[model samples]
Target: MTLEILTADTLAPVRHGFFTRAGGASSGVFSGLNCGTGSSDQTEIVEINRARVADAMGVDASHLIGVHQIHSADAVHVTGPVTTKPKADGLVTRTPGLALSVLTADCQPVLLADAQSGVIGAAHAGWKGAQAGIVEATVDAMVALGAIRSQIHAVIGPTISQRAYEVGPEFFEEFMDEGPENARFFAGGDGDRMHFDLPGYGLSRLRAAGIASAEWTRHCTYFDPHRFFSYRRSVHEKAPDYGRLIATIVL
Candidate 1:
């Protein structure tokens, strides 16, 4: 099968993509394009998937860099291939031939770029990381790499949409405690449950960080099993594990 990679015009002229689970070697629960090294999917199979992503990005497999996503606001700047993945949720680089990538299965995979400055970034923005300010942290890291705050364009990749993201009262309260305005991101669900608009929240954070342009692909992971991998869906189905989709950007 051919790989399905999604791109945005806002990040045009720079190489980037939000890859779908179309072409891969894994089977069963992890059927397509499982690029996560941390997953229980066969290590060799995962490597093969990642290598495919690198090939699509026009970079060597070793240069397809990523961090050890701890769901924190931390971001790191890398000049070249990294031997050791840092414990961060975001990555930025100004180096040519290096692809910044992130793995996601429902959580937002955000690709950012300032093509004119030759800088690019990729972030794993789960709700926790986003609430902790991962978006701003990524922009700051890019700025450290000579990218202008007002020149960066960010695009949130496939993630679970509001209609599929039901949360408990505690989850709603957590965001409300952050700020009452956060209530706007949640809508009434069943009784005490609420639906959170993760992509909407991501766009808000990107704009608030002063990015020149920000948009979501508007692809809902949970709703599109054939094209996406959704952690929430996997859990609901009682699957033991789920494949992770990859998103990448290179300068």
Candidate 2:
């Protein structure tokens, strides 16, 4: 099967994509391009998936860099390849040979670029990482790479949508504690449950960070199994593990 790489007009003229699970060698629970070595998926299979991504990006497999993605606000600035994936939720690079990438199943895979400044970034922004400020941190790191705050464009990739993201009151409280304005990102669900808008929250953060342009692909991972790999869906189905979708950006 051919790789079904998703792109946005907003990030056009820059080499970037939100890759789907259309082409890969892994099977069973990880049927498509499972780029996450952190999962229980086979190491060899994960390596093959990543190598395919690197080939699609026209770079060495090692140059398609990603982090350990600890769901923290932390961001890493990379100029070259590194053997170890550090513990960070975001990555930025001004160098031409390096491609910044992020892995996600249902969480937001955000790609950012300041084309005029020749800098690019990619982030894995789940609810925890967004609440902890991963999007803002990615913007800051891009700035350090000579990008202007007002010149960056961010696009949130496929993620679970609000209708499928039911959360308890405490989850709602965390956002409410941040600010009541955040309540807009939620809609009342069954009783104490509330549906949280992960992509909406990511857009709010990107816009708040003063990005020049911000948008979402509006692709819902949980709702599209044929084109996406969704963690929440896997859990609901009692799967042992799930494949990870890869999103990439290169300068």
- lDDT leader: 1
- In Å, residue 49's CA in model 1 sits off its true spot by 0.8
lDDT of 2 by residue, 1-251 (tens): 98888898878778999999989888998998989888898999889989999999999998999999888999999889998889999999999978899999989999999988898999999999999999999999999889999989999999999999999998988888999999899999889999999999999999999889999999999999988999999999999989999999997
Clashing pairs in 1: none
- In terms of lDDT, model 1 sits at 0.94
Q: lDDT of all predictions, in order shown?
A: 0.94, 0.92
Candidate 2, residue 105: how far the Cα is off, in Å? 1.1
- Clashes per candidate (backbone, < 3 Å): 0, 0
- Cα deviation in Å at residue 7, candidate 2? 0.7
User: Model 1 off-target regions past 4 Å?
Assistant: none
List clashing residue pairs in candidate 2.
none
Q: Which candidate is the best by TM-score?
A: 1
